[model samples]
Target: MSWLALWLLGAGLCDLAHSVRPARHLPSAVGAAGTLLFGLLAGLSSGADLAALPLLAGAVAGWGYLVTFGFGRGRAPMALAGYAVVTGLLLLIAQQAGAVGGAFGRWVESTPLPVLAERDPEQVLLLLAVLVAQMSTGNVIVRLVLAATGTVNPGKGPDATSTLKGGRLLGPMERVFIVGLGVAGHATAASIVVAAKGLLRWPELQARRDAATGPSIDDVTEYFLVGSFVSWLWALGGLVLLA
Candidate 1:
């Protein structure tokens, strides 16, 4: 089978594991096995030398998801640790695979999209912009969804805190930490992509929502907190995969 085909299979398996875990609550070992299979196949396509890259990424992702969602009270340390573990594993795979070829050299040559390729600055700056855009956009989108679904305060006049309560957004602390961790992950992955391909794409700002208010402060805070994490995931994924 082709490498890309193998990657597709692995990705499918990974998603399957994710889907089954919530309903069936499969054993952690089963999930680990799935990740192992995914890593093996994904490494084949990525030319990542680390034989265990898939396992590592899966474990980190699982831990992050669990700590933030499944068990704990959404600690920042867990999020940060998860990001570090995943990114480090990816880099190790790249190195082992001998894929780190002329990272900075390629940036001078060409890019996939002339427009997005033009914005190749330090990974930190790029990461920041992408993260901000993601959070802001997600906040707006989630708010609209809530308002349309009658979940949030309607007809305006509510403050930002009230409007966002019960909307799946995390509290202020969680939001800040998750955003920071996500940006870090993006930077790490972006660095790898840039090093390998020379060119990368910049994410665009798509939307913005009014910070309207609602009745419940607690609900809005939670919505913002949850939404922030989601935003981080979206932004980080886009930077690493889309770029």
Candidate 2:
């Protein structure tokens, strides 16, 4: 669980760093350093075995670096998804060995909150990490999926996002809302909210249908559907991972 959380944290922070500066190597370097530092913290706190720290840290750093360096390539999304699948396998092996909780579990018991603070520390940490991922990392994945699916052409330059506008921001907000509702045990409500997004964006999509510039209505509609569905699945999948 800790490893998965760390992977998510590394991904989200790496994407945020790249979005902030978009440098050739700065974001990867920052993410790797941050992941390693956090790995050391986990070891020191006995949240993970000392002997396993090196391997865990290596995984986090390697994946983080790859995320920064893999963007814009044809197979980048597939590669990233493959790494996620591998991480899941690693997590299963790690859990089978023994309990993953330690000092963080103890710390959670010490928290003042009656509800949230009483929950598992790894859960809380992962929730925070997923929320962060929903911001930038999710957007990155959606764009990659859009490109991969031909809904938007990355090679052609300026995908629907540039024309659609507000997607990069609206996406995070919507995903966070859905995740929050899920956490609050309002899955049905969350689904309703997800449905409302299409309605809310209907006018905008309709407006594009009659436009003379920017992405075509067909392209924009596909972008909306694909991106929204990807984001929804990502948020839901994160919850499943936490489980």
Candidate 3:
């Protein structure tokens, strides 16, 4: 659970750093160092073997650095690959150390908060991570997919400008709604969110359709379709992790 929290914290902070302009590297560096320190403390507090500390610190720090670097450079594929590899390795290590059932779990179980009384700390940490991922991290991932598939390009172009306008706010809200609905076993209701987005954007999309300049309708539609799908997938993936 601690590892999971640390992983999420590292990833989230790195993504946050990537989202900020000017002095991005500073946050990335600080985030990586913070993750390492917190990871070490978490490990020790959880009674994990001292011998595993180095590997744990290395994994957390490396994840932060790689994610920050990859996103900063617009290397979506590299960031995605790094995430997979590092998270996989961390999961394996956690399994070996039996790190999921420790002080955090006990505390979560004993908590008085009605909302969390029945939930484990792992679930809570995972939800927190998912929420964080739904922010800039999710946007970065969607853009990466779009770029990789040639559906969009980065710049001040029509599609890019349109997305840049409100996507940062909308993406996180939709993801949180989707994940929340799915967690509550109301997945069918989640479709309303998808519909609402389309309806709300219909006016804007229509307005753009007849514009004398900017990207073609095809490019805009493709960007919307691909980006929305990828964003929703992130939320669904979080649901899977929770399960």
Best model number under TM-score: 2
Q: Per-residue lDDT tens digits of candidate 3, residues 84-181?
A: 77667766666544343455556667789765676666566666666777777787778777766767542355435453267777998999899888
**Per-candidate alpha-carbon RMSD to the true structure:** 13.5, 3.2, 3.3
lDDT of each: 0.37, 0.69, 0.67
Best by lDDT: 2
lDDT (C-alpha) at residue 147 in model 3? 62
Better of 2 and 3 by TM-score: 2
On residues 1-243, what C-alpha lDDT tens digit does candidate 1 reach at each position? 111222222332333344346443343344445444533432333534354445553563464244324223334444444434644554444434422114332542355644435544223223333343343234433343343333433224434332323323342223334445444444544334223321211110011133233334444444444444454554455355324
Q: Rank the candidates by TM-score, best first.
A: 2, 3, 1
Candidate 2, residue 106: Cα displacement in angstroms equals 4.8
Error at 74, model 2, angstroms: 1.7
Against the true structure, candidate 1 reaches a TM-score of 0.35
Q: Model 1 segments beyond 4 Å from truth?
A: 1-30, 39-70, 74-76, 98-222, 225-233
RMSD in Å for candidate 2, one decimal? 3.2
Where does candidate 3 clash, by residue pair? Answer: none
lDDT agreement of model 2 with the native: 0.69
State, as a TM-score between 0 and 1, how close model 2 is to the true structure. Answer: 0.82
TM-score of each: 0.35, 0.82, 0.80
Error of 3 at 90 (Å): 3.6
Model 2 error, position 81 (Å): 3.4
